[model samples]
Target chain A: EPEVTQTPSHQVTQMGQEVILRCVPISNHLYFYWYRQILGQKVEFLVSFYNNEISEKSEIFDDQFSVERPDGSNFTLKIRSTKLEDSAMYFCASSKKTETQYFGPGTRLLVL
Target chain B: AQRVTQPEKLLSVFKGAPVELKCNYSYSGSPELFWYVQYSRQRLQLLLRHISRESIKGFTADLNKGETSFHLKKPFAQEEDSAMYYCAFRSYNTDKLIFGTGTRLQVFP
Candidate 1:
């Protein structure tokens, strides 16, 4: 079965540095989303995207976060500056319609 | 306040035993409920959704709107069924999932 794929399975960056996490959702899915789980915490939604624009976002997705579909097959999340609290495993998901979503292996981001 | 609650952090059972994972939600609008499983080294995968009203892998869940709950159940558990299960809730037009912390099921032989 075709699944979502993400790059840099693990990432480590210094605090205050910028990092871009990449994902390639299932080729035919129209809706894409980004969610993160801090260690031992519930997975929290960051943002949802469709038609090259953000559909909805959470409070945690503040000024530092941005998402882009720079190409037909790629969806990317960029964090302008990292903080210690930013360390978490970020998952990318997509769906053909809306509710049921498929998830990627996830990129574990560790901000030092 | 939209939230999904899986009260139990861990549930253990033996082979051939019955299993039930509890889940409750708080949402003003109608809620779409789903169960996602993540095995030891695997990514989260859909187990089943309440709307389907079908059983998968001998497991089934019923959406009790009156109780505001969607609990997953299996009459006979197999060792291979061990995994982390997350109960999720979504509102129409919300497009995002509100997930419970997750329940880890350990089915032993």
Candidate 2:
């Protein structure tokens, strides 16, 4: 079965530095999403993308966060500046329709 | 606002015993409900969806609009059923999933 794939299984960055988390969703899926989970916390939605544009975003997805589909297969999440709180497991998901999303293994981001 | 609630953090049952993982949701509009499971060292995967109304690995969940719940249940559980299960909700026109804290099911042999 085809599955979503993410690069840099684990990332470490300085508090004020920028970092990009990359994902390649299931090839045929049209909708993509980003979600995060703090250690010991529930998974929280960050943003959703379709047609190369953001469909919806949560309060946590502030100015510091941006998503891009720079290429056909690559969906990337960029954080302009990282903070201690930014450390978490970030997951990328995609679906053919609006339901039944498939998730990647997740990238563990550690902002020092 | 949409929120999913899984009250139980951990549940353990012996092999061949029945299991039930409770899930409740708070959403004004009709929403799609799903159960996702993650085994140790494995990625999250969809176990079942309410719309399908089908059983997967002896598990089934009924969507109760009156109580706003979609609890997952399985009869004659096997030891392989051990994993972390999350109850999720997605509203219309949205691709984002709102997940609950999750329940860790440990099926003892």
Candidate 3:
């Protein structure tokens, strides 16, 4: 089965530096989303994208976060300036035409 | 706002015994529910969804709209069933998912 793929399974960065997490969603899927799970915490929604634009975003998705579909296959989340609290497991998910999303393995981000 | 809650952070059961992972949600409207599992050293993946109404790996979950719950149950736990499970809910009007704090299910043989 086709699965969502993410690059840089793990990343370590300085607190003030910028970080970009990349994901290639399942082929032919239309909607894409980003979620994060802090250690020992529930997975929280970040943002959702459709038609190359943001459809919805949670309060946690603040000024530092931005998502882009730079290409037909790549969906990237960019944190302009990272904070220690940004460290978490970031997951990328996609669904065909419905709401049932399939998630990627996730990228573990660590900011020191 | 919609929310999901998995009360038990850890649940232990012996092999051949029954298993139930409790899940509850706070949503006024009807919601679609799902249970996702991640085995040791594996990626989080979908185990089952409420709409399918099918049992998988001897596990099944009934969407109790009346109780605002979607608890996952397995008749006989197997050692291989040890994993982390997450309960998620999303409604038709929303594109994002509300995930509960995961529960680690350990089935000892």
Q: Which candidate number maximizes DockQ? A: 1
lDDT of 1 by residue, B1-109 (tens): 8999999999999999999999999987888999999999899999999999889899999999999999999999999999999999999878999999999999999
The docking category that best describes candidate 3 is high
Residue-by-residue lDDT tens digits, candidate 1, A1-97: 8999999999999999999999999999999999999999998999999999999999999999999999899999999999999999999999977
Stretches of model 2 off by over 4 angstroms after superposition: none
TM-score for each of the candidates: 0.98, 0.98, 0.98
lDDT, candidate 2, at A46: 98
Off by over 4 Å in 1: none
The DockQ-derived docking category for candidate 2 is high
Worst 10 residues of 3 chain B by lDDT: B38-47
Which residue pairs in candidate 3 have backbone atoms (N, alpha carbon, C) closer than 3 angstroms, thus clashing?
A: none
Kindly indicate the candidate among 1 and 2 with the higher lDDT: 1
Candidate 2 per-residue lDDT over residues B1-109, each given as its tens digit: 5789999999999999999999999998888999999999888999999899989999999999999999999989899999999999988867788999999999999
Better of 2 and 3 by lDDT: 2
Question: Against the true structure, whose TM-score is highest?
Answer: 1
Worst 10 residues of 1 chain A by lDDT: A95-104
The local lDDT score (0 to 100) that residue A49 gets in candidate 2 is 92
